[model samples]
Target chain A: MGRKRTRPDNIRLTEVAELAGVSPITASRFFRNPEALSIGKRVRVESAAKELGYVPNLAARALASQRTEVIGVLIPSFTNNVFSDLLRGIYDAFESSRYSIQLANTRYSILEEEKLLRLFLAQKPAGLIVTGIDQTPESRIIMQSVDCPIVQIMEIGPDPVDMIIGFSHADAAQAAITHLLAQGYRRIGFLGARMDPRVQRRLAGYQAAMKAASLFDSRLMVTTPLPTSVTLGGTLFADLLAKAPDTDAVFCANDDLALGVLFECQRRHIAIPKQMAIVGFNDLEFMASAVPTLTSVRTNRYEMGRNAATMVIETIEGRRPEQPIVDLGFTVIERQSSVREP
Target chain B: MGRKRTRPDNIRLTEVAELAGVSPITASRFFRNPEALSIGKRVRVESAAKELGYVPNLAARALASQRTEVIGVLIPSFTNNVFSDLLRGIYDAFESSRYSIQLANTRYSILEEEKLLRLFLAQKPAGLIVTGIDQTPESRIIMQSVDCPIVQIMEIGPDPVDMIIGFSHADAAQAAITHLLAQGYRRIGFLGARMDPRVQRRLAGYQAAMKAASLFDSRLMVTTPLPTSVTLGGTLFADLLAKAPDTDAVFCANDDLALGVLFECQRRHIAIPKQMAIVGFNDLEFMASAVPTLTSVRTNRYEMGRNAATMVIETIEGRRPEQPIVDLGFTVIERQSSVREP
Candidate 1:
């Protein structure tokens, strides 16, 4: 084996400044605010810095200025479109600000969230933007330790860690249930994904709306552990028909699950909004183009991301944002899936 | 109006070191390599660091040691599952290495890639992982200036800047086409997503294979814009059928597009394999579970990610990597979609 290699000597700012024909302070200013310098100076400094392979001393800056210009983003999953859309919005908001984002995925596990929190805390980003507030003890400790601003997104928490920016899952679910109820869907069934706290909250909200309307019966609620796939939705529908043959409506967890459920209904010769009504959450772009146009609760995922990013950036700059608790709100999109003929 | 308030002075590492009864150098080493130091001293230093709200200065450490322990990843889109799976593999490899990832989506735009490249360079990450090799002139300039290792993923280029870890898209496409021909699929038509350079290479390979086999008829190839959803795939199939009514087989750019074509066949009461055999690229998980399981080209997406991450990490540590060009290989998976009875 080769002998252990020695550490490379650090490339200093002073050397870079000398190469760029500028003072050390000017070199520091280039790293802090490259745009503040003239175009010619910016080009010269960047060229010299690149030639020297210079990396700014972020730790020293953090100690002296208390700013890292890095944002921490905690997301549920990268596999889904909703979260991806939200991330795109956050990215757009910070594009011009030169603020880099650090992402951590919870993978739908509360335990994983705690681990990610500790990891994120070690980095000491300028601010934090998390999805919801169903955090573990260790996660809470990490969040409490963060002196920077925090913004909770996707769903409102009972008590926010700092700022809150999201639509109410309960309200969105209630809207879907009420739509089914209005269409004379008495024996309605609820289909959902497995183990997400937010989805569970939606299920609870759906049940509450049904109970408040005095329509909570044994035949109406059917829960199953199905993977979020269209085929699973099809299989679940078949099982639902076997259990409760008279079920006239179904409320799905989200659009992907709903699409699967719809495909099954179509295969079984079930006329939607005629024999059975279907309602979904998250009015994804495909919902409108879907056959029979799916009726869904439209949560503004992109706006939620934009608002959360904006709040975090503002708080990082030592500005108190006007609204710490931002409820972007949701809308019930009426489509062919739930509209019945008079 | 309230008087302008002054910000609190940031706490320094010197203060934490003083409180812990250790030198600032020892404290810095503790933050960089905690496990290497004595446990008794580690506990005392960690406690003091925590008590003093000491955020280990990352910028300072970067300046001093020339290692940021961060990796920059650039992808075209996260909405695609193939890219996401690749990312999962990369994350798995780096999880234990304690390297954080900063991701940016170029949205398949060269201009966006150039801009994002500049932003990534400013962070001074240990290594860079880019999705494809087709970069802009400005991006090329910035990439060359970085002294650290860079790995290009997903597609192979004629010449690599530093490292290339991916499969040959052209070869994979040719294999798919030859497999179709071997299965006696003549009058085969190609249905592809938008003209991404990589996808175009696959199309070109298909065209070459067709011509070599003396089957290069005008009616055998079809091309459309990409970012194609399953719905679009379905519509495109219908349009293709209207034009080439005698077409016996269709090769799609990806599984999503193939699924759409398959769905359209089901809708039109057209028989699969017997009427129109279908082949897809990227053997996604859903393809295996799909109703008449899809025939597809399986690229080692996860392995691609793992290899790229490992190479970057090892290169950063000054280890001479064994291979700079890694082709994990691809396979043609034959399922019900393209199978025909004798």
Candidate 2:
């Protein structure tokens, strides 16, 4: 082959085919399905395409000129296991489809989510999967203007641009607290961090349950806006205990916090389930192996991700979504950490 | 203002301009720099472009037809802290740039990596950052053919495809083993899981250190192919303790495994640093918070990621790489988990 030429994107496909000594149809076939061509023709066509700076995918690009085959997904947190598990499920669902997810991390900030949304809107993706229902007014207006299918995940809202796939955080948190109450523990304290929309919803859930049981106490809640970590768990639990020594059980917003709470209890010689019954959310792998084996709310994050992706793909392929609002509810797993013996 | 029309791939840009009652130059200018035109002109041009299915970035496409403003990143694992830290660094480096990472999870399978590479190659990304150096032969050939800049990360290899940014896992492992020997642990053991290339290299490092000390014993090492987890650490440590009851110290391949070993020690009432000592790799966020703060090799994953991205960006912008092979190296941290009492 002669010296490699830059993309003569200036030339036509017929000219490119002539340069490669092939028919226009053959050159077109090479881009769509090179497997159909023999090795000799395939190599020649590729070399000619490279030399001519061939950009044959234009037809394909034009086919979806309004929107690319990208499935734009927005999550509030990147490192959080909750979102990562959803990503795993999303990947699994789109694994066989012609779609690929364009992931954006919003740092659990509505402003950041808004910024990311504006950027994604420019691309006009085939569909979008967003986290939570709370969006800036400007962001919601943009969402409403877009004609493509949109799926809001992690929570259900009455006014979705198109669709939603998630459960009630309030109900889940209420169930966790009720579980502790049913086990005969009152004066339960809560530890929370990174008070994002979901966490706020969970707190509301906790408050509602406590109030219904005539045990609501603002002094029992310890919270911070800082990102959650194993150490934060200990710090928050310590704060809760210092203020409410009468605290008999604690419900952690996340497993990381629970791990910290467990470690703090171990350090203070506070007996678990005997003196303090603790519970966590998300039911991550470590909860099962903790010293006392922590109890946690088990939500089907993978299923949510998978279902969301499937919904986007089906909608993009022109299949009407059977349901616009899907509530993949949560379940609380009874483990040793939160269970007490009479 | 007209009814929504599909991309008319067959029509020319001039017809689109006339239909929207705008000059062809104004239509072209709108796609090139919409900010240059007034809001009304911009809207008209955009509608014309939409109605005609105009792909106006043709000039921009020709300028970089072989690539887009995307940096394709392929990693063996996604949620792993080690890789996540690297991602944070990569993002930090590219934070100010026009580039965004198009991440693909290979899940530690070479075939999957090869498959992902083929798809990315078709997109003709601006650059690529890949994990490890052990790509399939077929994959390497394709990498060689692609003219875009490529950087290999996570391990410093003698023969890199183009450029490399990482440290020596074997050396780090040897250092850990040597640390235990200095602490007076004679019957030290090694526990590893998900023996990927890096894990195998770590095992090599351990063997090298033990052999040099005339303490090499295959019976002291326990391994499995299951993905690493805290619970896996406990199970593997149990197997090691069962087979070699005299085992006084252990070096874990990853933090998850180390956490498990620590938990197991706690469960068996084995006093850390008294009856047994432990060390882990990757010094994750939880290492310092563990019951007996775990000692570990702190690899500069974030820095490596940042450096790799910086290198790719500079090279793509036509700057010569100062050094094609960068070894950031690793550090061993001393903590209570591996600190023997006097």
Candidate 3:
């Protein structure tokens, strides 16, 4: 066979419109805003476009309308299930609303986050969704300069740049601590990974609760760098036990770390909720499946994503969301890991 | 005290250029492509832009440049550590390359994938990174219509649209079966989740290997529609035993299911390796840490993401990648779960 013949190019809007019995202007308008046309006409244009294998030149559209229908999402890491789940939720919500999400991860570094933020701004997303409120001066300035909706997720802070959709990390921490205190676990400890502002909020909340219950000095708090793995969690627990021998309960930064601590305790033959109790944040899937079922705080990770996407879409459409600060609450799931009695 | 006023509206590009003693055109050019201009002039424009907090309108720039510099990623699920790790690698590789990733999940549905593909096309990403080769007719049309680079990941196919970047699922399956067969396990069985195209590829591969070894009509293939949860895995194993009473070894779709099977076997007092041997795929984090370290196929999931990202970026830059079809090799990690030799 002769060299596989190449398909002809230059299939234009005029040809598609002609085939569909509509004007080129109508076809252009159909792509720009299909909702504006009648259903019959819209269907016809879509079919014609599909038949012709049409891909509208988005660059031309962007230049004409100055809207790309894309949003920038910057987070610390994707390996963290919490963030990944949140991203999934956002993707789902955006998909339904016909928006696309662009992602950047800073790996939990402010300097890196600053660089990513500048890059994101240069790309000109219709909106921006960042992990938390804390940002570098340069990043903050760039965010302020961008004329797009801003959303800070996973943590709450005073005076958000524009919109904030997250829970009070401090409040969740305090509630976790209070639950432990009420259970009569006086010897408590806090095991955390990373000192990102969000984690710090949880730590502050934990401290406030301990001090309020007159157990501040009695409790031990261990803070490590951000993004701790399960192995690190196991090692951190061993380290904590060596220093605080009497610790009867522990609050971990998140479930992965908590699971690690639990595994370590099991290895040491320590009876859980008998010799010690444990609680974790971000009640991920493994938490429920773990041998004893890990006790943890369940944040609405999916809802966080959905709400953030909704807020961004609404902002892009010039429809201000009624509530800028949408707090999808967290629940403390009491599993065998933290239950002291029947 | 008087109510604290919100910060004034952000400074525009004109204001920054005027303050920096340059035309708006020069300032815009400096921001659009900094590398092309003189370093001193670029620095001055950037400093002035920083001082004025001028953020470029990305939508407009994208329109003029005909490149969004964003990659669209379509994944199956983020909750799975394999996919999450892969995404993390992709995100890391793309971090400094001036390209962002837009993610969508198909929920393992071909129809949903088609919808997502159409949505991705509307946004006009610079490149596309999708999970598998399986595509609905409409999705295939959209993929073919797109004028940019397209990379199909996770599972390889015989024919790729533009580029294919992932391990061969069929090869991985055959390798696992071959390893078990070598260990003198003749009465082997295969256990898997819902039959997706990728899973089908593995199943076909397993069957081919079994037939090649003269084990056709063995009645040892067990399939389930349930997710690879621990409880589900246990139930699946129980069912498998009831149906194939003489089966000596089983290969699971993933480690999660394998772990479940292991848990059930333990509970039933069936001696591992002595009574039954098992092999799993994906080599998730918990596999190595399980009570009996799991025997699994170590697919470089993270590297898959990194490679896919690299290919997309290269395609966007008009650079031909060294190879369009990259088969990052897989290895069999022999652990206690399948080791039977004394």
Candidate 4:
């Protein structure tokens, strides 16, 4: 093969085939389905293509088929560790697949998500994996009308647009509160940040569980609209103590807040479980490795992502899932931070 | 607007224009550049398109232009907090732009990165932003030959594939050790995981710093190829202790490891800075909220990403950056974790 600097647009598959001393159809097959070609012919076509700088006209191919091998994914935030695990699962499941991922960040705004939905639909994506069931009315209408496989992830709810998979956020939050109550701790305070829809559902569950036990106190709740971070976690916990100093336990919206609460307890000489107890959502890796291993609600985020992608791909391939809605469920991991001394 | 179930492939641009009572060129302009159309025409075309369930033929447009309004991003891992900050910058920079992001995870494999490079080049992206400067030779050749502007982020080095922006990992690591040395700590060890090229540079800096002071010891190092995590940080610190129990200070490759080492020290009753000083890289938010705030190297990850993206976009728009090579640099944030009581 010669080192030729052919213009990307000018190098055709036929020229590559001629240079490789193969039929044009064989070279074309090498580009579309290399597995169908023998190894010798595959190598020859690839070398010739590389030498000639033959870039496949993906646009022309997509135009002919009226579809592109692309899966559009919409998520709220890129910095949040929760979504990171989910994204990893999605990427892992599609590693060997033909579909390329087109990711859009909604920035936790319903309007932004709606705009992105319109854009993706315009591209005629092979499939889609949306973050949650909390899209705006316009987004919902567009998604319902579109003809593509869709997977709603991060929370399970009624009236899914297509396939859906995720545990109930409210259910998980109530379970965490129940575990704390079982440990003989009342006067439980809730610390939250980034009050997104899913988090609001968690707060609702906390309220429901507390009300059931006749331990609900309006002053026990402290939340913020600001984005969540360890710093914010500590700030919210401090605010909670200022409002309800007699609080015996705290349930954080997520693990970052839980770790912050733990650090605050350590800073103030507060004893774990004795003077104060803490429970967190999303059993992030650091929770188990903290000084006092933290108790947390472990959601199957990775599994949710992997399964959602698999479902979308399978649906696109004409294999409809037996159950359109799947609840991966959650686990309450008991640890040193919340276990009381009998 | 009618809720007609018009087939996506059947609705043409001309029909949308006819319904809106506008010329076909005006309808086309509404899709390609809404800002170029007046508010009256834009709204009319949009509503008509929605009513008719019209989808823009982006593939045909891409073919005509020989480019896509897509900026391909290649990163190593999704779960790493370091890259999360970087990705947020990239996404934020392009929030209002015409280009959409096509993201691919390389899983830290050079060969995988090369494969992704070929795939992305085939799409004729408007621009590209790649993580790190450690692309395989084949990938480098492909990148160099590509027509679009490119930015190599994460770390800086000689030679420009197009443009580059990042800091020196070795210099940052050396500065971290110098600070530890100034604190009167002689036996400084290193803890690292996910020994990617950048981490290897940090290890090299640690070695250089120790050797300069005649305190280098092969026993004072623990590195792992396994992915980095808070749990792995504790495991590696435990192993380091077993190998060099007399070690007085440690420089972690990232904040996760530093946080883990802090927890392990607390578990073992080792007074931080009093018994073992700690330094971490990236200075994640948790580092500040830890009981004893941890010291860390503050790299401009967000700035790196935002600026890299801005540079690529500007280059594509025919406005070359004032400087082709950018070094954002790093700062050694002194905190309680590594500061010895005077």
Candidate 5:
């Protein structure tokens, strides 16, 4: 669809340059690379541009330069709090920079991600930050062929497209299980929702840890393909209790589920950490303030996002990161929810 | 910063056209206006493009047409669950459409919104969906100058730049208070954080309702300019108690604070509804599933987002909405948290 060309009070760079008593090139340089311009010229251009309400034509500039000052970020779910924290870090990193972010939601679909990737690449983004390491063969080929630096975030794995930043989800889950085991809780159960690639890995880690302790039982785990929510957490926990009535501890895939389990326990008059201990992943802000101060695995989500964006920006500006793959790692934060009274 | 123009295996549209036995114009038409092309020609062009691995250069198309198939969206916060639900609706609305969203976070600053508005206008987006009604005077003028359709979301007010869709926050808060009043609760207090314009309106509503009952006391309220969180909710609730020890009910600015207040009440061994009633805004999923099920003012956030995007796209496609200003409204859901025993 063609857009209406009705722009009132259109201001030109040449007009701003004339008003500021500077060359058009100087004014352009003030917009593009202001550090290269003299202080006097930069100040004059800025003031004149402000006075004229001159907005540079980014579309034309993008065509001329064959690239946009846009860093394309592909995230799985907008509703997930995890990505929101990551996005804050990404936005915070680019706040003062010239580049603006163009975000796309893949809805946790690899095919959708691939499609979005194609669309983003067509625009010739300055750089890209994709969600995870798992990608289709065609998508990987497309990414490898692109010249801009790319960062795969959320989990670190072998053979990254370019740079990678994230911790091991499996390791984080295993640590949470280890903490529960050390707290003298046995017959531990697993509760998960929307078993995405990362959640699946977490489940794998839980199974491994339980198996190592000779406590692994398929009946102790309950999962649903429905999108994760607090309500779903309670429902899944109830299902887990029905399937394994003697369950002493529960490990949730995320904090929302853990919070749900806590609420369900309170409703059922079950004393937390005495009858049932709870552990969750992604120690969200609410976890520390919950009634029992829920125990959770703390992943460096914000730092991962910030570092990934910085790496892409640095590579774009000619400074490559010394470490191409960074595993920020995770910590199992033990709170009152999982601590038993000795 | 200049980019490396090293796109490997660059496939030209001319080669696709030759392979498809069609003119380059037909190949180009397939990407832009496929509906206008004959089925045979469209099929041939699609296959040819697929075989050649041709990605249409969006920058070049944007320059040629002077407009992009981009619908710019600006939201205040990324971490807030309220906006995340809104974003999901917006993304789902644009999922199958040719237009992609270019999201910008203003971080609750009107000045930042103004800067982002200017940047978005410079690119000549096909349409725009901006959050809230409180835009800077210059920003308003800039939006008015642009030809693209703009929809202001999150709150309905007088004097929209183009179309508008949202409920009244003040009215919603007033309703929540009314529900509490009807439940036989008096001496209600207010808990707020992040005092944004919308949250301020909610506070105003709380004050108006309290004054109507002639039970309003300045000491019965506690608020902070700090960002709202569950932890902050608990801390503010504690402040409210210290300021007004006789407070029997509390209305939180958002669900996070409400949840925090619930957790704090649990920690303090205060009976919910019996000792202190709690009501929250933005009925998040966790509200209905909490131990005592929380009461909340449920605003049509997802519908607001979907309707706003649809309005923008409809206007861009040469069809104007019959009702330019839409107030979707809100519902005060009564649950165990606010219902006192008969």
Candidate 6:
């Protein structure tokens, strides 16, 4: 039956409720907060909504509830694989939920993040998931005053806007460097690109690890402000090799650099993990398939994303997580690119 | 000045009008239709709005004008690198404009796309950018009835919802296979993973090229409906090799498959281009960084995204493109992996 669809979403909640074999209030309650309803009521309501082609007027609902049926998600880059992976987890988590996602790409600019936050806050989203702890003080103030629950992802920070869920980039970096040292790479160098705040934290971890081994040398660390690419990885690694040929190993700030180092070494006929050990960050799917499978920091990016979404949604639904700040931790996957002992 | 930001957004259109040195009516008109106003008035109103950190209530605005200040984008997969590149282009194009984008990932499900389109339609978005033309017939009916302009990207078809901006995946695949044939590889095979509609089109192209060359062996074409990954490439290529031992080259459905094939070749100590050639789709940024430098179909994904966004915006602003069906076209970028001649 083709129902009379009006100017602005004419799907009646009563029709959906009748089809779902539930009360109209129950159907509406499902949209507002599915957690409040029983499982049978929730499934039946959802199925009916789908069959009847019912789409809740999020805009009208927002007006009445003073809560936009939207989630504000901020990330650094769209092209970056890391954020893409994190977003996959986020979308997966949010798909079954009623709230729509509103994404903003800050491009690693704190000012841009602040500006986007202003725009997002105006939407009065039900929940928010920000990327890191590096938002501007002005933006932080605005965020603090907001009524919605928020979760900062991808970095473990002592101070959070509301709650945070991520592994410690610094500690993860240290583990990567320590892995290299344990595998007999003493003269290890560090290569970084798009040296954002997170990269800086990773560098600090590398420094801490090297210093612990009494091999602290600033000369071996090469960095660039340019946006990162696989080719840039090669450029930075070549720069490191030229600057410090004695460097027996290198810990890359991220996978691109590590991959670049791998390619550059291959082009020049330099053996890996035997003569020059290399470690990358964020074990991208490609890293595993690369020749001499790359060793890298394996952060639970998907889990981090899922947890962040869960934290905000739960907080909004009156289910507070026991711990506001969750340090998911990281693991260093030992592969041929780093672990040579085997 | 910490203004009392509250329900209904404390920043009023009057404040924006005063800041821009214009009447409130003019400012409101600017938000409604910038094209109706002179350039000077439009700039002044926008700048004033930005300076005062004002965000127009898009929901309220949509009710009055029946045109939501947003674009509804339906994508297949967010995690896939190809879609990410396209989204990067889309985001860049929409960033400067007043319209915000609301994206929903359909996960390559036609039903999901239909559901999302229904939801998106209910929102009354100003325009819509759908990924492919493979919408369900029911969904197609709804789409045809929508008053807003629509632009479908990624795959160009004869019957677009309204407008289309993309290259033919089939034609692109044929070009790739033709390139390999020109390179004198007669025993070339095709490896496809996650055979979504686009990939299916690509496969048809492969079949077309191989049949014309009289080399179409059904045994040589290996495919999996499982989601694609770099390692999946290795697995599928190995399976292909097992079935067709004379396979001298392989045309992958996408870059991930190509990368996997390359890694498999390396693991097995097979020489690239010399012993076996390879071609990949979607010349992703990392393709060039691979050891032998993969040759792939270079599609203008970013341009497609940008063009789609531009078309939607221009339509909303009352400007129509000369053509509704745009074939942006594709190129076969010759690289080391496929170019044994040059």
User: Clashing residue pairs, candidate 5?
Assistant: none
- Candidate 5: where are CA atoms >4 Å away? A1-54, B1-54
Docking level of model 6: medium
Best by TM-score: 5
Taking all chains together, each candidate's TM-score versus the true structure is: 0.84, 0.86, 0.82, 0.90, 0.92, 0.91
In angstroms, the error of model 5 at A175 is 1.2
Give the docking tier of candidate 5: medium
Per-residue lDDT for A184-283 in model 5, tens only?
9999999999999999999999999999999999999999999999998898999999999999999999999999999899889998989999999999
lDDT tens per residue, model 6, B1-342: 654556464687899999999999899999766899999999999999989877677666655555677899999997898998899899999999988899989989999999889888887888999988899999999999999999999889988889998989999999999999999999999999889999999999999999999999999999999999999999999999999989999999999999899999989998999989999999988789889899999999899999999999899888988799889899999999988855
Error of 1 at A134 (Å): 1.9
Q: Write the per-residue lDDT of candidate 2 for residues B204-304, one digit (tens) a residue.
A: 99999999999988889999999988899999999999889999999999999998988898789999998899999998878888787889999998899
- lDDT per residue as tens, model 2, A144-230: 988778999998878887899999999999999999999999999999999988899999999999999999999999999999999
Q: What digit string (tens of lDDT, one per residue) describes model 3 on residues A1-342?
A: 554545336356888899888999899999868898899889998999989888766566654554566688888887777887898788878876645677777888889889878766665568889988888888888888889999999876677888998899899988898888888898789888877787888999999999898888633888788467776677778878988999999999888778778778866889888899999998876677666677899899889988898888888888989888888778998888788785
- What is candidate 5's lDDT per residue for B1-342, written digit by digit as tens? 766767545577888999999999889998878999999999999999999889777777886777898999999999899999899999888887878888889989999999899888888899999999999999999999899999999998989999999988889999999998998888899999999999999999999998998878999989999999999999999999999999999999999999999999998999998999999999999999997999999988888888888898889888999999999999999999999888
Q: List candidate 1 segments past 4 Å from native.
A: A1-60, A137-147, A218-227, A263-276, A289-293, A317-321, A334-337, A340-342, B1-55, B137-145, B218-220, B266-269, B289-293, B318-321
- Of the true interface contacts, each candidate retains a share of 0.30, 0.25, 0.46, 0.96, 0.93, 0.70
Cα displacement (Å) at residue A54, model 6: 5.0
Candidate with top DockQ is 5
Better structure of 2 and 3 per DockQ: 3
Judging by DockQ, tell me the better candidate of 3 and 5: 5
The runs of at least 3 residues in candidate 6 whose Cα sits more than 4 Å from the true structure, single-residue gaps closed, are: A1-54, B1-9, B14-27, B33-54
Question: Against the true chain A, what TM-score does chain A of candidate 1 give?
Answer: 0.86
How much is A24 displaced in model 4, in angstroms?
A: 8.0
- Best of the two (2, 5) by lDDT: 5
Off by over 4 Å in 3: A1-56, A182-184, A216-219, B1-68, B115-125, B136-147, B181-189, B209-220, B245-249, B262-278, B315-319
Q: Compared with the true structure, what per-residue lDDT tens digits does model 6 show for residues A122-207?
A: 87888999998988999999999998999999998999889999988989999988888888888899998888999999999999
Cα lDDT tens digits, model 4, B210-321, are 9999999999999999999999989999999999999999999999999999999999999998999999999898898897999999999999989988998898878989
After TM-score superposition, what is the CA distance of residue B253 in candidate 6 from its true location, in Å? 1.1
